[model samples]
Target: MIYLVEHFYSIQGEGRYIGTPSLFFRFGACNLKCEGFACSEVAPDGTVVVGCDTVYAVNKEHFSSQWGKITKARELLNILELYELPEKSVDIVLTGGEPLLYAQDEIFVEFLQVLHQRGHRICFETNATIAVNFFKYEIYKECIFALSVKLSNSNEPYKKRVRGEVINSIATNAKDAYFKFSVDAESINLGLEDEIFDITSHAPSADVFCMPVGGDKKTVEANTPMLVEFCKAKGYNFSDRLHIRIWDANKGV
Candidate 1:
């Protein structure tokens, strides 16, 4: 069964595909806590519920009851039917909580095959830690991988967050791929350059993109200029978190 946190049709808000109208499939479960950036709210019962923007997708225990356990491809496809596409072709993005955690999954792969056959352009927003066994699974080759390699700002240990083999696999096998790093003043002050040096040392040719880390328009405004200059000076691409600017990090894009 494929575990899904939520799915929606919204414009691409980050990376090279920014501003493109697309469908998003957010899979549940993640390998890293990245607890430093957790957000919270008070429920009707006055319970303090805390999590990241994708907290429901990350901490399964907190949100497990809400997850959609898709046992069949048609059940998943029925959700896509709501989009009412221009044709069978449309841009589709798979995100997470680390959607690639199911890279080796059988039912998920079957669903991917059907999607590919229908001409949907698939994109995976991944943390670049889980290695794709490309030799066994050919569906991965049909998708574009937008790798967001974690940095010290996430507060995750280096070994758990960055996996060289996975980055290498995505770079070597995906239909196309690029690197996107979440940037903030804190990340820059904390030797983000050093982290980049380590990643690029291994995968030097990958196109690098930097997105300011923020939850709301005000915060995005505060962080954008620094990230822009940082990207300009370093010759990397600057990405805008358009979704936050448009909706202030609300649920369902």
Candidate 2:
């Protein structure tokens, strides 16, 4: 079953492919709840809530009520036709609560194949915790992986977020993969430069990208210069959330 939370057309906001106009398919559900005090806020009831920007997709308890479940690739193709994608090659940004969570589902894989056959560039924005076997799932080899591996700042326990085998598999199999990390001052304070080595020790091929971890422009601005300097010093790349910078973190852009 392929559960979709929302789909839209927008410019690629970050990573190596920044600023490219693209079609976005946001899948529903994820295996991790990467909470962090840095991104948390006190609710009206005084509960501190750790929310991801797309919590709608990740919080499965509400997903059935909100997500659109599609059983066939034809239905998806019809929907993409509504968007009237360009005649030339444009990227299909497959995002999620973790789109690869559906990687093993044949129907979902067929959806990907159809998009690929149509000449759309498939870019997956993943947490990179799940590994793909390229021999069995050849379609994955054609997609670019925008790997945003969760870090200590996300408040997920080390064992849950970092998997050496998963990292090795993506490094060894995916057509091309880039390691992007969500950053905050706390992450730098914790010596994240050293932590990157620990996580990518197995698959060191892709360059690392660090984007300020914020949902709004102001928060991102506050952290940008430091992150840029950090990136320069560490020889990692820097990516800004251009959508947030331009549109103030509005959904369905």
Candidate 3:
């Protein structure tokens, strides 16, 4: 059974598809906790506390009670129908604490088939650690994969998070995929260019997006200038965390 986190409609705020109206499905259970990069906190009284920038769906300890259980594929499809808005064609964004952790190829392929039949676009926001053999399935042809590669700044051990082989496989197989990197000024100062070049060496065809690690407007504002300068110097595409800027880290935006 798949452990679903949350599903809602929101604008695609990061990566190449920024500012697009889309339906977001946030699945639970991440392979990586991303400890240092603006994470939830724990209280002295044993309560799990989160930062102001985290979305309710992502702050598992606080919001787990409200998550819906979606067992059958038909039930998930029905849920998609309920979130369909008027006037704009919707794109389905499958995100996660790590959605791929729970989703198997068979279930995802079947779901993709149904969504494709109805003319819906599919986008997978992945951490690029899991080796998804999407080429084996027909649904692979109809999806846009956004491979967000975590860097050293995230505080996740390299062995646990950055698997070069798996990332290479996705870049080699996926029809359309983009490489997005999360960064901060310190990371850039410590030589983000060399790290980015290493990533680009693997996925040469993928478009690179460098997004500032912003959880609030203040952080976003603080990081923007340095990120812009870094991007200009290195010739990388700069991305702003628009949802956090507009909503100030509000959930389900």
Candidate with best TM-score: 1
Q: Model 2, poorest ten-residue lDDT window?
A: 37-46
The sequence of per-residue lDDT tens digits that candidate 3 reaches over residues 14-113 is 9988998989887765676665676454443456654323334455656676566666678778776686486545888888767676545456567778
**TM-score for predicted model 1 compared with the true structure:** 0.94
- Candidate 2: tens digits of C-alpha lDDT, residues 23-115: 898999888877672454344445555667676677666445668888887877777778766788789998988998888988888888888
lDDT of 1 by residue, 1-253 (tens): 5798788888999999999989999998888777655455444445555645566688766567768887877777788878776764778899988998888777788889998998889999999998898779988898999988888777788999888987987898889899988777767767777788898665777888899877667777888887888888888899999998999968796
- The model with the greater TM-score, 1 or 3, is 1
lDDT of 2: 0.83
TM-score of each: 0.94, 0.93, 0.89
User: Who is ahead in lDDT, 2 or 3?
Assistant: 2
Model 3: CA > 4 A from native: 41-46, 49-63
Between prediction 1 and prediction 2, the one with superior TM-score is: 1
- How much does each candidate deviate from the true structure in C-alpha RMSD? 1.7, 2.5, 2.7
